[model samples]
Target chain A: MTERAIPWPMMALAVVGFAYMLLPIFVVVLAGLTAGEFLTFPPEGLSLRWVAAFLQSEKYLSAFFFSFRLALMTMVVATILGTAAALFLARSNVVGKAALRAFFLSPVVLPGVVVGFALFAFFIYSGMGLSRTIWGLWIGHILYSTPYVIGTVGAALAAYDDSLEEAARSLGASPWRAFRKVTLPNISQGIQAGSIFAFIVSFGQFEVSLFLSAPNAEPLPIAMYNSLRYQFDPSAAAAGIFAITLVIASVLLTNRLVNIRRLLGRQQGQ
Target chain B: MTEATAARATGARLAAPALSRARLTWLLVVPLLVFLTVFFVIPVGLLFATSLNPQTIGQVTVTSDLTLDNYLRFFSRSNYLLATGRSVALGAIVAAVTLVVAYPMAFVIAKTAHPGRNTALLILVLAAMQLDMVIRLYGMMVILGDEGLVNQMLRGIGLIGAESSVQLMYNFLGVVLGLVQFALPFMILTLVGVIRGIDPSLEEAARSLGASRRRAFFRVTLPMSLPGILSGSLLVFALSISSYIVPALMGGFRVGVLPIHIFQQVAEGARFQFGATIAVILFLLSAGAVAIYLRVGARASGGRA
Candidate 1:
């Protein structure tokens, strides 16, 4: 506590940064309540028409369901694959471990666009672009989101003590039984954190789906992007508000359940 | 630290008997290894092959010959090279700016008194991950565009006449602002993780050495945080370079980045070979930058610890 004046410059910088971060969110929330036809700021007036419109539209409703189901499926698959990889890497004295870890984590470093391109080419080459089905979108989402899963689970397992599993084994448990009864519970927080991340990443994906989405199947972000690009409708803003609400709720719920603050704190590098 | 981590790791293996260990390890890693090889490694190799041989670019029989013309064209054209340079320059500047802005913010969050700091970080992190890129870009347009909020506010304030042509959106500044806004959270989050891991005693010792607050912070805190700063900056730069939507939406059609060009080449212009080559270049650049970042982090951590 030096009796110095407040660092006004630094404080101003902080204000600007926070404002920049929050401005879009504020705009979307505000515009969602707009009475106007277009997404004008200082919105013309307050109304719930667009929200009602969004809910009433069948296309939006189906796409929303499709996205939700896909995200959930991606979350489960990614969590399983990622947790398995994390467990293997954490316990294995395997040769070429560093290279293997890098390969597994490469999705994190690769640009989403490049991954989207590669997947597009590979799918086309393999004649897997038959129907642009929900399955294709799910596969792409899993590819993109699995890295975060592996990272979070790996971090959690690193903090985990082996003694617990050993204790289980010494108490007349089989190796599989010990791992099932001991290791899984200890790393549940990681799985929870990874699942949330996998969900959010899969849900928010645009780049991969941009190449992969069919005319019939589109993620919400792609839908929003197309809507905005094609028209200046307030529905985009309404969609944004909905997405933000989901994100905030998901994050808060995960934090409440798993102490995600600590998970994020440990997931710096991963 | 690595030795201790390794020793503890060895204890896990010793938990299982030697007879079943080999089989277990093999089984454990098999799925992961196969998944990576099939989906990731092979695809990247195929991409490289397509880029090398134009015959595979979407079944078009342009040529059966192997050529470096795609790479040469990107380099030989002044506009292409200029866009690449601009992308790098913009990336570097945004990363530097984000770092400078985030350091104080991270320091405040990491060192501040309890509840306020925690709330601030939670909000920042959550807001940062809110993936509404189009709306975010729209908000930016409003703030910076001609008929946007800032201009409206400025005109109301009588800061300048109503006839002023102070264009802000669809330019370098707009693009940079959006890039910085989007990438700043990543840097802050990365730094927060690293900074929180540093022992507070190091700063306390410097403070007790009869040093001024500024001097202590510069000598102790900043040096300790270098690894975080380096890694965060690299990550930010890599993200900025590869970003397509932000630059495309905000930069009008005047300013072209590598990604924007690649998008046009692939989707609009139908130049698959050139587009694949550009994607490869982008991939290489990001990987190279990450490699350099990890090496720097290793050296700095080794030096300090």
Candidate 2:
């Protein structure tokens, strides 16, 4: 492809814009290393003491574990259900296809606050006890993340050829066997991409989780929020850095699994 | 006659599999539809119902007596009305700002020939989007705090006195800044897709037809990207209006946006009915905007919803 000259102004803007996006994250990482009790930039002395302290804290550790478990469950359930729905929609001449698609995807457009509030009220009205809050949270996260899975898997299915499944069936394979051996492998990229999105979204979910979480089962975001609210300490910065690192790692892993750009861009089914 | 009867029976057998396949398709989708209906749709429906339900304040009781009192009280109170208005206005501003800043970057990412650069930019935006909101807001607080990096830098450059620093956090400006940062990646990603879909050859054609670069972009590129702009803005606006953490943190719990108000009513005040009312209002506003956008998009593209 012949390279076209981009305007210098646009290049300059891109650099500035990227820096704007990244600078806060960079600062948080830096702040996490500060030896001072309070958050400060260009630290008086740099050390890993804050990170160490945050890691040693049981509160943060438990919150991390809870969030991890929640995310895993959400990923598994959402990926399975969403992939099935995507397969059906992509292949079948289902009536009300458009309406069904919108119904599944509406959570994407629905406000998180609304979802949180609604779920909270629903749980209360149903007399689900505080012990069930975790389940409530799980349900909410699953609902929120399923759309991402559907979008990715649907896009993948749209591009996949039905002839391959047909070919397998013609070769004396059962429908289930054809799907398991052929179709599944072919769409694994979409499934993996969707899983990553679901996991990340579940892990970082705040608004919905906030409403559902009881005192003892607080997720990482809520823990972090409470820490920030009650204390102005650098430990919060350390926690922030930890979360950022995890997100960056997930993004890198996702990039390896599939073209992240395409996954995000293919939401319109094109 | 027996041979003809056998052939007819075989034809019925041949049609069975095709009929079952269609049923199987519905079966595959049933789990998801049922899950969403019970967990998502019903809960939200109940929430709207709760908005109209009668409430006994100062106690945890809700009556089945239908009343518009909650909504009426919501609008009658100046504070609630102001917050609702502010939230919508803020959402609009954030959407506009995010689009303005993201468009050029997205254009570059979409048009650039350097695959490496494009991938790097895409990863940056993706990573940013995946980052936790609480963490990002914390980072923003540190950078925009009274004694934070921005202030320190300005002081070092002799822009401000030693005791004086800009009030970057704990106000409307701070909330807007945090929201814009949060919404940027989404807008950029959406716009990138739209921009990439537009044929570069179209711009060349326009240029060859005696159009300047700016004119070519305005006439050919910009108009084509309207769908992206609409959808992106709608998403950004909806998300921002529903945002709770950013405004709560950056606004120091003082800036009473609709979500925060709803949260306060529920969490702090223990008033679920009032909270539900605000939530219903907020949901309607954002959902209405999105519904309108979808209708327009469908009409323009002659596409299904």
If scored against the real structure, what TM-score would every candidate get?
A: 0.90, 0.93
User: Per-residue lDDT tens digits of candidate 2, residues A1-270?
Assistant: 542466678778877887878888887887788878765545788889988888888878788888999999999999999999999889887678876777788786777888977877777777775323678889989988998898888877877898898778667777789889999998998899888889999999988787888777788998889888866667767877777878888888878877766676666433
True contacts kept of each: 0.34, 0.66
Candidate 1: residue B103 lDDT (0-100): 76
> How does residue A66 of candidate 1 score in lDDT?
76
CAPRI verdict (incorrect, acceptable, medium, high) for model 1? acceptable
- Cα lDDT tens digits for candidate 1, B56-101: 3445223447888778877899988898899899889999988887
Candidate 1, superposed: residue stretches over 4 Å from native: A1-9, A39-41, A58-60, A130-132, B1-16, B55-64, B115-120, B160-165, B300-305
Question: Alpha-carbon error at B141 in model 2, in Å?
Answer: 0.6
lDDT values of the candidates? 0.75, 0.83
In angstroms, the error of model 2 at B7 is 14
